[model samples]
Target: MMLSARLLLAATALCCFATTFAISMDGFATGHKCRCLTTTSEVIPTRLFRRIEILAPGPHCGNIEILVTLKSNNVVCVSPDEKWIIELIARISRNRQQKKPEVFSADQHVLK
Candidate 1:
């Protein structure tokens, strides 16, 4: 009887370990979770900034993550995908393109 009891206890411990491993590996069997924090105000950035990333929904988690990298290397997430946000991103893209410095040929150089 004692031998049978020991086997039962070992089996129970093994089952518990397996359950924990599965949960941790699969993230509760659902998927990875993603959380994004965005500003509530509609105030867009004025200075030039990096690309406006468009994050779509996926197994990573619910909602999207819009990362707005600024000139100061500050990253801000703009959630809700609002019309104004989209427009703002477009404006930044256009401005960055226009801000590119023009390239000149070697013949144009006259160094003293």
Candidate 2:
């Protein structure tokens, strides 16, 4: 009876471990998206600060997309697809300064 109990416990533990491994491999599991934080600031002039949301999956992290709607100019524009939202912000900064256009990586979903 003692031997059988030990074996049952061992099997249960193994099954739990396997289930956890499988879930982690799936990527973007439940409650995983809440780990990130976003901050918004006005770029001045016609553009107003807006919120950032993750539209699609990414490689290590995830693809961060920013939605900006200009209240004064009455226009809405979404940042182009990029690996990180920071790159898009950099481009906007350049444009604000009347500098050359910048390019950033568009690859979002990258499996581990």
Candidate 3:
């Protein structure tokens, strides 16, 4: 009788562990799914953009994603292959490179 009880307890524990593992994997798979389903080639003016997010290709997504948030708080996915989009990305990169923070030197410090 004791042996039968031990076997049942072990089986229950194994089943619980398997169930937990399967549930965790389901959440993981859904969370890593790609954000963009369809993209547009239309070029939006830079001034209308409130924010721009560029996500590179990875295991989660096979293509580059360019998500632009407009001033109206709407998000649009733009095609990365578009010529104007490429130019816009290049311009943004150049601007970022040019706007490096200045390093402070001890000699430039002033006592207030």
Clashes of each: 0, 0, 0
On residues 1-112, what C-alpha lDDT tens digit does candidate 1 reach at each position? 6999999999999999988887444356564666564454455655555666777887775576777778878777675557877777688789999999988897897669
lDDT of 2 by residue, 1-112 (tens): 6999999999999999988887545465655552334534434332254433344556444645455545454333344443344576676678888965656578765569
lDDT of each candidate versus the true structure: 0.71, 0.54, 0.88
Q: After aligning candidate 3 to the native by TM-score, how far in Å is the CA of 94 from where it should be?
A: 0.9
User: Candidates' TM-scores?
Assistant: 0.45, 0.29, 0.65
Q: Give the TM-score of candidate 2.
A: 0.29
lDDT order, best first, reads 3, 1, 2
The superposed Cα distance between candidate 3 and the true structure at residue 29, in angstroms, equals 1.6
The 10-residue segment with the lowest total lDDT in model 3: 22-31
Off by over 4 Å in 1: 1-31, 89-112
Once model 1 is optimally superposed onto the true structure by TM-score, how far is the C-alpha of residue 10 displaced, in angstroms?
A: 22
Cα lDDT for residue 34, candidate 1: 65
Residue clash pairs of candidate 2: none
Q: Can you give the lDDT of residue 7 in candidate 3?
A: 100
RMSD of each: 8.5, 14.4, 5.7
Instruction: Give model 1's TM-score versus the native structure.
Output: 0.45
